[model samples]
Target: MDTALIVTVVVALTAWVFLLRSSMISMIWGPVVRSAGGDAVWAAVTSVVLYIAGLAAFALVVLAVHWALGGLPARALVLVLSALYAPVAFMPAPDRGARPYEDVRRALVRAGATEEQARACAWATGPLAFAGLAVVGGAVISVFAG
Candidate 1:
């Protein structure tokens, strides 16, 4: 119930989501957005809605975790959460030619990107990217809060 703890949880959760989920939205939903084609307004609106909804859902989860770890210090909670999520982020990257990656690349190509550009973009979406963002973000938040 401490104001400082509340503020730290909110700040750390917001930063974590911005660092992680926002990128995921673009990567996972980019194809759908591009498929809107000439309807730029529709695409933009849908993207905005998705982002808002995703943020809300993610925030709820963070709040639940915060409540569950109420007895823990903010910095330790942050580190524990980060460590728990690290396994997910550290999962081996799928092969570039794997079905999901190929599907994403193909979608991008169909959406008008060149093969090379699509390939690079698809590669960038690998979960491995989450490792650095999560660890660095958690450490930074913990330091600032502590």
Candidate 2:
């Protein structure tokens, strides 16, 4: 509600959106686009628009959580969410044959990365990276928010 908190939320959400978009493009869509001989510019533009929309929706959720929790510090909320996500995010993919996993791996491989590299990239750019960002960002925000 205060100026400091508003500032913090804006900065945090912006960073989150940036990281998400970058990972999505580089590790996911970029490969697909390249393999399909699509226009990178158009893909980038569409991705940015979609990501910004997602950012707006996520911002509303963050605000709603802040209010619903009776002014719980956003930093604390972030930390809690990150903690909850860690197990699920870090867990090995249950099935390599799953559509999403196979598609991502295939894309990366088609983009000229080796099988091992594709696997690593898929894991890195997926939930693991986002959850890690949340944890680290939350910790840093806590230090300053406190």
Best by lDDT: 1
What is the per-residue lDDT of model 1 for residues 24-77, given as tens digits with 9 covering 90 to 100? 434555554565564545554554455345444544545565566543564465
lDDT of 1 at 122: 47
Once all C-alphas are superposed, what RMSD does model 2 give against the true structure? 11.9
TM-score of each: 0.37, 0.35
TM-score, structure 1 vs. true = 0.37
State the displacement of the C-alpha of residue 37, model 2, in Å, after optimal TM-score superposition.
6.1
- Tens digit of per-residue lDDT, candidate 2, span 1-146: 37787577556654554445434435544444444344444433443344344434544555565566633466567555533333323222223475545655565556555565555545544443454455445444542463
Worst lDDT 10-window in candidate 2 = 86-95
